[model samples]
Target: MNLKQFWQNFGEAAVYYPQLAQKMGGVSAAILYQILGRWLNQSSTVQCSLKEITDATGLSEAEQKLAREELKARSVLEFKLMRSQPEIYSYTLNFEQLEQLILNDSAVEKTSTVKRDPYFPPRRQPIAVSVTPHYQFSGPWRSQQQLEAFQDALLSYAKQQGYSNPGGWVFKIIDGISKGIKSPFWDEFIAEKPLGSSQKIQQEWEIEPGVPYPAFESERIQYYTHKGEPLESAVAKARSELRNPVKAKDLWEGFLRKCDRIANDALKAKKAGVETPYLPPSFSEQSTVTKASVMEKLSQLQGDSSLLEAENPPEKTLSEEEETSSDIPSLESLNNLYQSPITQNWVEEQIAKHPEWGYTIREGKVIDQYPF
Candidate 1:
């Protein structure tokens, strides 16, 4: 068939395997056309390895694999060993050509010349490629259980949003944590930081933050849309719409879970005479004091009344000396006073956008509120 006719048939096949059409590049498609057309005209098998085809067509290995699968899936080509030499044997379609009428000519038919194995047939194994975008984790996490809790929290959030693959979603979560990738979760995590403050920055600036979490791809099957939409789109949608704001509100809850796990590990570690005690901020929050009160007490410990006033204080009461003294500065302090409240409000606004956690931990137990 001519290129036009081939494409027409290929387009018809795309309803079932849309990725074949979606992933094909110009060179790879051309190579498919050339190889199939030549085989039809010459009536013989073609000897070409993946490297040779890539070199001849100037296509990359990835593109060539895509094209090869596209043709194979359509039953246009077959890969098998002929006399112990790997070769691509072209199968001619009965509708595309006329068979010779003479009895002797029947033997010359390409279909008759081809070999088949009934027991062990040539089957294509799908290659696992990284199609999802990278996710990275930030902040401090000392134990594996704490890390796992965070991952579980993300998976729960994604599933609640109707995602098809919760494992894949969890892979993205772990991937993000290991690589320090800037995700919506991290965006929300840093939102509460004090203004003009630099948050905990990772050391290696050159590293690709989106690197897939180690063992993540191997541990689970990646998600793909039935329509064959790119995996990246699903991840993008998950980070922005499905998981973000909800994940932000779930931060303290996730942190608490992580803390419980950390506390268990810490108890074990302490029994082993390990001095380090790992506790999430939520665990600290559980004591009779809140973060605000802790900050107040810490300020008192430091003997800095100004620090206490900055964190918590009664309504403003300016002394005549502080009001009139140019040495105290006014405009800069006024700007800071206004800016801090606005930043705090914005952080609270992001938290307020989160969807309520509705997943069941088990039967009759659902996480429906934050900071539990």
Candidate 2:
């Protein structure tokens, strides 16, 4: 059927039949007319199924059935289900009855002679047109509980970071997630820092009295690495010293001087072929030393029992060690060690040494040890 021609005809008919237009002033009526109009240009009768109506109108099965029944009651359409296949139905457009109803409505409208102002024109009744319905899923993709939990986590994080308004950000994040957008940052942020605790320290440095401002990024990074402090702690320390501007300036100068001294000591140690306990200022500093020097230090540490003992001593006694061991590698190292035969043997030996612990390995990794 030519939909454009059918739509033009339908509009003209509505003008000629104001009552018919008024009767079709609802979504269901408009939908029914659209469906019937599609078949009218081709033939009076068309065979179809409920699914076809749903696909064409984007209405649910229940909505389509209700609309079909409404049209049937108004004597504008007729349909009968096939006896053999209940799903299939034959529809007939009752154009004769529709014309008759339109004429009757027009006659009734002409009989009502309502007076109008000379300057005011009569307003025509608006006809409802059916466009494609846009369906929005009401519930979230995830469960309500899970969504709420994530929102709470975001809110807590915002509060910790001193956000003036967190609801707006939380709403956007939740809305994005509802639309199937993944939030990996949310997962990582929640894992690294607890909800109520700030992950990054808030820092304010002072160039003048009572005029505190944020520290430079380079200075903040240097302070965090050199002091072996978390970003949040380093920032807090700097902020605390800002109350007294002169004292704060002195403290910063002292910190810079300490870094210079440490750097000089490390340089002298390198010349004397002595390994310094202090870490390099940055990875770039390590590159300044020869590869052979770095490897030689590693080789020496591997051979020297004293250094190894200082880092990780052998378990003294079961009474003292119990389930924990000073010699046990970190969780990160154990994860890597899980794939090694040597590490596996070492783990088995340790388990044998402490039979009371009832150590076990599952999926090629120790399962009985407490995971930190």
Candidate 3:
């Protein structure tokens, strides 16, 4: 019994597809593949939602779309949209295609020649939306009308109960109080806030963050936040400090120094540079020289002018070790290629420039950008 060589595929609980990962040249496609494998275990055809797939794979909505395309192009899987409302879809794996892919590559591939992946992001925890314990529907919702009626009932409950800010969670409160009863003893009862609720992206803001704060302003807030200040408070304080020239100057210097330090580790990436998994603070990938870092460096700077670079330091480029692979395009690489102001013509230009990307994929394929 070759224990290490054997795979316990029957009871595989976590996400991975090593051979498929190698073939896909990245993890997103491999993750989607494993998720599909799990669904197929139940039946020949399995139907599920995009959210289910996204939750399992931990890939963003954008990355999930790309993963499906990669699997399709590789001829390893088929995905079809089953329904629209609430988004139901099904995937079928082509086991024969997968077998051939592994067999052919395994037959001739030398251990020395096969490249190793530099970094693999850990699986992000699924943010499952679970109903709180002791919570159930207010009434039997056998028909769509009953569900609609619940809304009117909720408004009446709110008015009768004098609820001020419960417009968002009326259903949550109603469900908990009703406990699946055909009729509750009272029309309205106080509902405790659901446990494990996600924090609002922005709390009731007392200061202007301009929706997305300016880069330097954001860094200033993050620095304070890291030090345990509330986000809204941080914004107010950051704005006030930035208004002072002396504080702002000190912060900019500190920002430059901080960025220089981070860039060194990121640019010399182990495999494709940006040593850290996911995004990094490199000029080639993303600039750490944003307004926020600058503000943080200057506003709260101590005696540290000697160690930092000049007013504007040279941008760090990716090293030989971090250069992007020149095979079938990875989604991340394609995304980097298709930067902001992504129009159809701009996408086409990038495609023409990188002909290899077009070999397996159509020009401008799956490069979804806003407004185009």
Against the true structure, candidate 1 reaches a TM-score of 0.17
List residue ranges in candidate 1 displaced over 4 A.
1-27, 39-41, 81-83, 86-372
Give the Cα RMSD of candidate 2: 22.4
**Candidate 3 lDDT tens digits, 1-372:** 676546664344465868668886578888888777776765556777888876666678889888889889989878788766548877888878988988888877765585656697456678989779985354545555756666666666566657775575566655654575433323322122322122223322213422322555667877888899998898799878776656766886786677676665556664575445433322233344665465335423433331122223346566632442332344544443344342334334545555544322345354433323
lDDT of 1: 0.46
Q: Runs in model 3 with CA error above 4 Å? A: 1-13, 84-86, 110-372
lDDT of 2 by residue, 139-204 (tens): 343555665676788897777768888898787776775577766545554466554343333333
Q: Could you estimate the TM-score for every candidate?
A: 0.17, 0.25, 0.25
List clash counts for every candidate, in order.
9, 1, 14
lDDT of 3: 0.59
Model 1 RMSD, rounded to 1 decimal: 27.5
Model 1 Cα lDDT, one tens digit per residue, 250-306: 543554465568778999989999897765332343344466665455434544435
The TM-score, computed over Cα atoms with residue i paired to residue i, of candidate 2 is 0.25
